[model samples]
Target: MKSYLAPKFIIERDTERCINCKVCVNQCSFDSHYYDADDDKVKSRIGKCVGCHRCVLFCPTQALTVRENPLDYRANYNWSPEVIEDITKQAESGGVVLTGMGNDKSQRIYWDHLLLNASQVTNPSIDPLREPMELTTYLGRKPDKIDIDKQDPQSIKLKTELAPQVKLDVPVMFSAMSYGAVSINVHKSLARAAVEMGTLWNTGEGGLHPDLYKYGNNTIVQVASGRFGVQPSYLNIARVVEIKIGQGAKPGIGGHLPGEKVTAEVSSTRMIPHGTDALSPAPQHDIYSIEDLSQLIHALKEATNYTKPISVKIAAVHNSAAIASGMVRAGADIIVLDGFRGATGAAPKIIRENVGIPIELALASVDTRLRQEGIRNQASLVISGGIRNSGDVIKAIALGADAVNIGTAALVALGCRVCQQCHTGKCAWGICTSDLFLSKRLNPDIGARRAANLLRGWSHEIKDMLGGMGINAIESLRGNRLHLRGIDLTDTELEVLGVRMAGN
Candidate 1:
């Protein structure tokens, strides 16, 4: 009952503007809105409000408004209200605090500190409208050298031996979001969009649904520690197989899908018992060292008959550079580096905000290390975490990433309000929920078109940016650090980004 002592959000209803339609009453999932028979008016129970703005968006009368509570609790910098509330909640329930989405704390977003440079008087800028710009990217190991025979001087024959490669029409791919964490509609939408965009979408530790197996040509199947829903048929269908070592949201930790969300469809897809907790151990017990990782990499390759490329994903930690080098040496065709800003279905509030390094620094350092070792061509690099628009994607490529993964941005396109209440399995938007009624809020056909439009529009913007840099092709922007400059940063910070100050 003490939980009602303080309401975080205040829901206000204007009696004059209200039409008594009770739309808010029917729309609110939190049960915050109601009708008082004696008063013959609509009212709000502030204690139950979560400030999602769902009622405000759906209300036609324009009578409802929600705001943060202004109540004070003896403000203290060291013992702030948030701190006190956290303590109280912990004291009340002996459970770890959970949060969804990415870290919300104030941290240095390096992208904001850096700026892109355009052509000057000496160098002329090319117009994308008049040029044939290339956006095609190949994700796989490339041969050190191609051989040609000089035996026949008139007709020289060349030997072509290539490892597995996944061709993309654009340099963006959807990041991991498991079947249990998101609804089947989301998976269907992403699958359709990926096929339309000529890119790929990932199945993050969740087993593939039989209905979605048809999208195998444009899907990347993930094998996480729990091995949920992973079978030989799943491996044989995907164009690429990813071994998930960890993610940025909760590095050094496994994933947890609460039992409440394990519905029949989710249960069938994951091949797990219904109404039971789904847990992925912190580390794959079978993998302990680089050699162990290599064993698994080769084992996956063997399973797919060397027809598909294998990718290894790791969070950007302090030792990410060395770790990436080890992964490349372990025969991984691709390396996915997830930064601190990466999103998740659910994670502990503490770890989500404090445990990983930024992708900018990690990408720059890993690229430099790999180049210095003369093995940069051994594996392709993909980075994710807080990639918002086409500009962010262009900047990431300039910083040494071959591609950027879009997660939160895609969810936003599907109408997510970023309420950060996904862990409760009661998402205001249907993108993150398992409830049949809530899940129906998203139509796969419409969501697919929206996702496709976002990618298509972003691809055009990327080409325009490349053209502004006096380049006609996107490949010229890849790892070309000279095209970027830091605005205001220490020398060390600039060095880590491998970019000079603007005007230098």
Candidate 2:
């Protein structure tokens, strides 16, 4: 079992007042409390508590109280409440903030501000249960037109074999998160879930773990600047190859895996010196310009023998449209736009809140620019960075995305409280930490099943939304501006969104 020496805050329950309702047990997203069948009492494994206050707030009897251990350090001027709390815990243990995935602070989650529309009674909502509800989606370029030679069927040759469609059972995809950030068990769980659910999971810029090769057909290998654990064999073993330009949490800033967290195994996989920081440089050495981007794309294609689709992922920014256009021109088969306000393992507070644009505006602008340039159909669009539920997924598609990538939501399904302490590595919930004992708290089978259930639930809801719109298939919803309308938006916003007045 992995060992740690950090002081912990414990949540105690008033045994006299505890009625064994299991309310606190169920309400605690961290799974800190459980029913002790032998003792006939509710017990809290307080070490798992992240002080989210969910249990305290939800306890009907107000019987729960959380207190910091005396050993917990007091904050000094150098460390604010948040910083002190993080450092105290991590400093005592000497570990990275063990977060599951994504940044999840109270930063602006734009999806909430921008809402979806359901067909009015006048438009007539179709019954999805009775009718055929279509959620099947293809994630690749669509041909503008199919040429036919009716006069000489045998003589006519095809322009080229069309790119194969990335057949998603649902429009939702598991977002990129590295194996090192999470655990190999966690990676296996995600891969197994993806294959079972007919979706895809991204192998974050961290190279593919050899153990996960079985799920290759449903995997998308990611290549980032550091080239950590990347090789021709790794590149060749994926359904799609994604080039990560930036992340929503820290757009221009790169990731730093402190030397302390670099285990021998992790060091070997990443091809870095043991016990030294594994720094992913902010900018790729090969990609200085759009032409340079093309060279890297070609290199990957050559390495993979051009079998897998190539995707470029960029953080949403003010110039996202221009950047996306350049990526398409750089031979990207798909483009993933990660919005501002997305979750992260660890990022400076200012950068997390200020660096990137909202997914809504970025999606609209990029789609409009690509369509205007007559190149929208040349590649697929996948939007990430705070996609919360099925409604957000449907709205993203109608706004012009081919699919949605979810990191935060998937982690929630696997038991994350979003305590915002991921960087400190002592994830009370086993989902994020690498500690053997803490990690065992999450059973990979159960976690993977839960994730699969969440995806299945969302798929059903998406189908219901599409059916309510009188739309039969997910493809019909792709870039269907006519089915959408803006609310509380200014004239300029409406113009940018390509939506007119509600009645019109």
Candidate 3:
């Protein structure tokens, strides 16, 4: 069947520099490059290229160049090139269009519109280089009041009982990315980095691998609808246990790890059969209401003997504020909101681009609602999805996020190009694939160092930003939206974000 699709990228090899080394042929996982015995030359079939740039990176002589195919079509804003190509692709495949990573649409990124305030003269900014700046954060419920008994100035006693909390040296955590969805080396890297950075890393419903049990202190075991590998040990081994209700990338749909990506190791870790697709139902069959959710939350706490906090993760949606209120009232110690721009291993193109609300607005609303109801101290708030840098992390904290999670940013440090080819299980960078040959490309030792270095750099930047605001501790910045001002934003956007306009 002669398909009507054109090559997405054009591969141009410099024949004069090409040495016919077959390096491109071996490096390309998409089968775009091939060795032609008839002509004794290295050639490329551009149609199969996914634009991963693996071959281009490995070409010793630097003879290969790949660029967007720039195929012209009738100009119609309503029927844009991408739209027409999507329709054509579906017509030929008769299957849902699948993609990896977050939404690439030109949606309003609130971070760019929001500006941070710095102290001028009255506040007197502190120098982070010479002064002490605290970035330590705790994730868990907090007591409304603490009772104290002062027998003497030096011998005060009688304190309030504190809820179990996970202490983080910094407020940034590595977001959940499952085993089957990515290679085990990536998991090892995350786990090791979390330990070194004194933060936590989530295991995204794929369950924990046996080797990762040693990093339990820095691990967050996830329980999705599938309950792939839920056991008493699994519940007890982690610092925190999170219940995954929804993700920002595909809110209403379930998670799908295709059978081809599921190997023996993944099957063992997730407790599913080898070569079987791991699908988590959209909704937890056991949870119909907030009451049901409370039961499960209590069940997990009971399983862990109340030694750790239980977190509830949900996608940022229209009714997030109301839903978050219920979750706190339902015995949740921590609430995680994954915003619309969150990344994923696989999701339908339609849903990834359309559904869910932005994390900025969602964070502001939820924080405002919680404060209004005086339940803000009952549970900690953590935001995720599209957190790109330390500036975004500090902005999130000012908007009421106790901490932020980074998935795509962490992957980028590990060499992901955001090529969106992860779902095909052919990730040339080896960060997102499970194939033995490709998975080894990511060395856990090097990966761990790179991921940890990212945290270190961001932590330094966060302290600098905080010091510029004349704040020495991160806790003081929490829910302090006064330090944030909006530019090029609507009145409604400013109101929803709980921020004043710039120059106000």
TM-score of 1: 0.96
Best by lDDT: 3
| Per-residue lDDT value at 96 in model 2 | 51
User: How well is each residue in 119-187 modelled by candidate 3, as lDDT tens digits?
Assistant: 998889989999999999999999999989786879897688889988999999999999989999999
* C-alpha-based local distance difference test score of model 3: 0.94
TM-score of each: 0.96, 0.82, 0.98
Better structure of 2 and 3 per TM-score = 3
State candidate 3's TM-score.
0.98
Sort by TM-score, top down from the best: 3, 1, 2
Error of 2 at 131 (Å): 1.9
Determine the C-alpha RMSD for candidate 2 after optimal superposition of all C-alphas.
6.4
Tell me the whole-model lDDT of each prediction, alpha carbons only.
0.90, 0.80, 0.94
Candidate 3 runs further than 4 Å off: 152-154
Candidate 2 lDDT, 173-229, residue by residue in tens: 999887666666677778888988999999887788778888899999999999898
What TM-score would you give candidate 2 relative to the actual structure? 0.82
